[model samples]
Target: MATLPKPAAISIRTVGPFDLGRLSRLHKSCFEEAWSRSDLAHLLAMPGGFGLIARLYEGGLVAGFDAMRGVGFSLCRVVRDESELLSIGVAPTWRRRGVATSLLQASMERCRAIGAAQMFLEVAVDNHGAQRLYEEHGFERVGVRPDYYHRPNGERVAAYTMRCDLEARCGPSRGP
Candidate 1:
């Protein structure tokens, strides 16, 4: 049998203000309606808002363009005992490689560590893959929003509202 190459190492870090540009670029690469730097800044500036960035590091190269590349990101916010996942995306080339899973898991852990008892998210009704992922992670569809997403071509799409009990799935909050 041919020997298979090992998977590259992926590291995730909390997004800082200085990383807005990189986050914007990665969002653009992953979504057609990417959030602008100003928009990301606004989101991060909100109270209880937080973001995470995932980087894929290949081999020993650690100081150049190809050494570390942004592959995915998740934006979330906690208000009192509830949290919402604002957005999440993974680069096309890195899809199906566990990047999104890692981001989601990290986001959940972060929210649970704070004081969030549950997490909510919206996904386009047609996005079955994302719905499956959310379901696998203890989320369940609670409701639906009519015409929630507007496309560039002027079409509106519906979305499903999903919720996950953080306290049940991740135990209780550790601390602030």
Candidate 2:
């Protein structure tokens, strides 16, 4: 068994257009297929599309070490009353930490703030770790996509579609 990295000071911030390069690098490190910088830029520029990046810091370090790099990110797009979690990635070394959870929570809050009533995401069936995280965050498996993902070696993987009812989890909004 492998040991996970120690938890460090982490800050979650909204990802902007300027984060394309960093986000692209992190995505490539985590996924078999990485999204291009242009794709990330287009999504961030689209209406109701937003993203969040988590920066990991080593405590008691120099200025550069204080903001090492982005360890995780989540991208979401809202259409009408629904929001879809388009992508989420965390570096291998940063896995098992609270980075992904924090990113999801922040994204959910943003979605609710923007009047989204529900959120949905797809996770690979083999990714039990991510599935557990999503389930812990109130997402329930609703369906499955057959052969939805392809591996670098040409193997196909199925994905589970999970959904969370924002209104139900956060309760009814009091309104502005």
Best by lDDT: 1
Q: TM-score: which candidate is best? A: 1
Instruction: Estimate the overall C-alpha local distance difference test score of candidate 1.
Output: 0.90
Note the Cα lDDT for every prediction shown.
Answer: 0.90, 0.87
- Displacement of the residue 1 alpha carbon in candidate 2, Å: 5.6
TM-score of each: 0.92, 0.89
lDDT of 2 by residue, 1-176 (tens): 77666566778999877889999999899888888999889888889898899997875542565466788999999888889999988888788878898899888888887788999999999999889999998999999999999888999999999999999886664333
Tens digits of per-residue lDDT for model 1, 1-176: 65433337778999998899989998999776888999999999999999999998876654567777888899999998899999999977778878888899999999999999999999999999999999999999999999999988898999999999999999979866
The segments of candidate 2 whose C-alpha lies over 4 angstroms from its true place after superposition are 1-8, 61-68, 173-176
What is the model-wide C-alpha lDDT for candidate 2?
A: 0.87
Clashing pairs in 1: none
